[model samples]
Target: MRLQVKKWNLSNHSDYEKQCGQYCYKIVKTLLNFLKFLKNENDNFNSIIEGKDRQIAELQAKLTSLYSNEHKPNEFDSLRKLITESNTAVINELRSQFLDFHNNGEIKPPYDSLKRCQNESTEYNTKVNESKGGETYIESPYPNSCVPFGNSSKQYKINVAGAGSFHVLCDAHTAGPGWITILRRADGKVDFDRDWNAYRNGFGSLNGDFFIGLEKLHYITKSQPYELYVHLKQLNGQTIHARYGEFAISNEKEKYNLIKLDLYSGTAGDYLKTSKHTGFSTKNKVNIQYAKKFNGGWWFNDYTKSNLNGKYVADNNLVGMFWGDLKILNLVKMLIRPKV
Candidate 1:
């Protein structure tokens, strides 16, 4: 009776168990395939990342090589060599011309012009042949004066108008302790009419009093010749003898004039001034004063007076004048023995 009951439901139960086993096997296979695909994708991503890193490194190396200062390639080197050679050639040519002038007694009127042209040409060539990003150094002239001393060689230019009066007073070191007075001549005598007020208060005195009529035009050609007149005056009064410095005509031209004055001594509050009756008018003016107080024969400031009878002295350091568009094209240093 039992065997007959169990056999009656056995077919359905077996079929259900077989269907569940097949479904479990399919799920396991799908999981394994998905894991394999994931592993392959990870490998591909890692390869792409490494490739990008290598590309970045290469770009960095290329940039470094392009911008390095010391490793400028063949093009820059060639350009540098060319410029060096050109400069050497130019210097040699100049030396030859100088030697030729020395050997021959030919006073050439065009020598200055030629020299200016040569200098300009050489500068142009140097600029053209120099390498890109290369640097150039040019020495400057002495500032405030044609000649420079000490540690500075700074240069500056001063331009004046045509047919106009211009004055420059520099430190005594530049002109010494001397004073210079300039006046122009018209038909005769000092013509103090047109632009005559230009010279008023040209020089100030140590006592704060200005010299009114100190300048006069001596002659026509001589007046316009750019003369330098130096005078000496007593400090306390007109009794004590002071030194009168030297003078020089730096340049004399029909269209322009230039004068240089050198003086000695160091006095305070003493200055140079022009007069209203002076024949010339002020076009451009540069005034530099040197004031010093004497203590035990040494120059000191009023605040630093440690000894009695301290006298204030004013010395002319430098004085110069230029007319008709002052152009300092070139400056040369010349060592000369002091005039006795």
Candidate 2:
């Protein structure tokens, strides 16, 4: 019985030892889990703190840049002022060099040769390159939209007498607001660089367009068939393609003093007088006027050769002088005598 008691006590002691080892293992595993959790929290806090520090550094750099004078608003103001000053200087230069007929009336000589052609009509001294069938070959100098004359599959021959005054008429009503002019150049050879006189208006001035004087074909005497070029230029000073074509200006019978040119097509009625952006009719006559050489290219509308302020000028714009917005359609030379 003693032996049995001792064996039972030994079994009890072994069971107690096994239970304590299990408890110790469980506690150690719990503590290790808690330590891992703390480490994760510490890593999270450290990452958050680093992100906030980066943000603060960015803000500090931005503040430093704002305070720097190199990026100040006044620095930009200086650039703006420089641009404004440059524009003003350019405008002042143009004002000094620019010359208009309304401003500079009758003047003598000693002016620049190019500007001289603006008023002097007899200053044309260059000959043009001859064209076959009097067709002018032209190239445009603008980078904008220009109303094109419909393509001509075959060129037609409209003979203008080298003698007497020749007239032209465009009867097409243009859709847009644009003015046209017939540039009368003496020489068929156009040198845009050297022959500035050939490009000058009568009285030898800086302005080449809007000129009506000796430089233009205002008055002419009988001569051989001259290759007179017919160029259509813009009057509004817009950078549009200028219409260009040439017709054989040969000598013809001086039966009538005036030759009224009409559009060969029925388009003659399309072109009429316009004022303040409104179109008006010209009862089969365009306001044909003469710009005298002495008057510095001022228009004369009086039908009377004596009166320069023309009265019956519009009675014929077909083959005469007037700003128009029409295509040079068919060439129909219809001669009309001026009423006394």
Candidate 3:
């Protein structure tokens, strides 16, 4: 069938255009608003992710610390045991080396034996002190003195700060008629006792006497004050002497004093003597006299007649003249004392 043909109308077309324009505008506005919402969501998501990451890192650190603390005791105990074993091994090795040295004859057995005996004696004394509920009073040997127990030839010197007694010991190969002269610092200068006059004047000669001068002694006393004891022997095998004892000095200036001890042996009773000039010259002289009873036995006489110059001499045989054990208060007092 033939249908009626409808024509397109202008008014209807205008209305359709207006409606389409309105729908497009609505879609554009919705899209813009949605995009803004999505941007905000992305920012929130990133912040949440970062917060989670930080929490995870903190947990990991705490766990690591906990694990370390849990395992520390075992590690510390193992390390401590290792150190203890190492120290013991080292001590044993040293003991073995010491024994080997003795066996090889590198050093004299008598000296070694003496050292071991001293060690044992020291241990015994320590034990005795412990048993008595008291601490042991271990006296240090004169500072810087070449002790007989060591291998080096360098001697030690000690400075005594005050008036006190000191015992010095020395060892030498040869023995003969000799004299030991102990001297003190009288006027801040070092002087030899008059007993050394015999050797100095060539009256009695010293053959194997090892003369160590005051400059060397000063070096010894720079770190620690005192001089090494000299072993003086004569040509004749008439007398033998090993002088090891203490010397005392009163506080003149209260400065640390220096002294020298000489061990000499030659003629019978060759000891130190002093002569005083009372009237004109007022001069004093020290002389060496012979002792008839002790063969090489010498007396420390004439010490009073010698000039007491406020100084120390080089060849005085006085132990602990350089280093003395004084109470802390006493040491302070001595250091602050006026110079003579």
Indicate which candidate wins on TM-score: 3
Model 3, position 141, has a per-residue lDDT of 44
Candidate 2's TM-score: 0.18
lDDT of each: 0.30, 0.27, 0.30
How much is 127 displaced in model 1, in angstroms? Answer: 7.7
* Tens digit per residue, CA lDDT, model 2, 1-340: 3554322233687876776675567898888997786577546545544553464354345434433433422233333343344434433433343333225532232234323222221111110111212333121232111112222211111222221232222212321221122332222222211111322222221222122222233222121111121222323322222111211111112211222222222322212111112111122212222322111122123422211111211224333323333322211111111111
Global CA lDDT computed for model 2: 0.27
Superior by TM-score: candidate 1 or candidate 3: 3
| Model 1 Cα shift for residue 185 (angstroms) | 12
In model 1, the number of clashes is 31
Candidate order, TM-score descending: 3, 2, 1
* Superposition error at 309 for model 1 (Å): 32
Stretches of candidate 3 off by over 4 Å are 1-143, 148-231, 237-239, 242-244, 248-270, 273-340
* CA RMSD of all predictions: 28.4, 30.4, 30.1
* Reference-based lDDT, residue 61, model 2: 52
TM-score of each: 0.17, 0.18, 0.20
Over the full model, what C-alpha lDDT does candidate 3 score relative to the true structure? Answer: 0.30
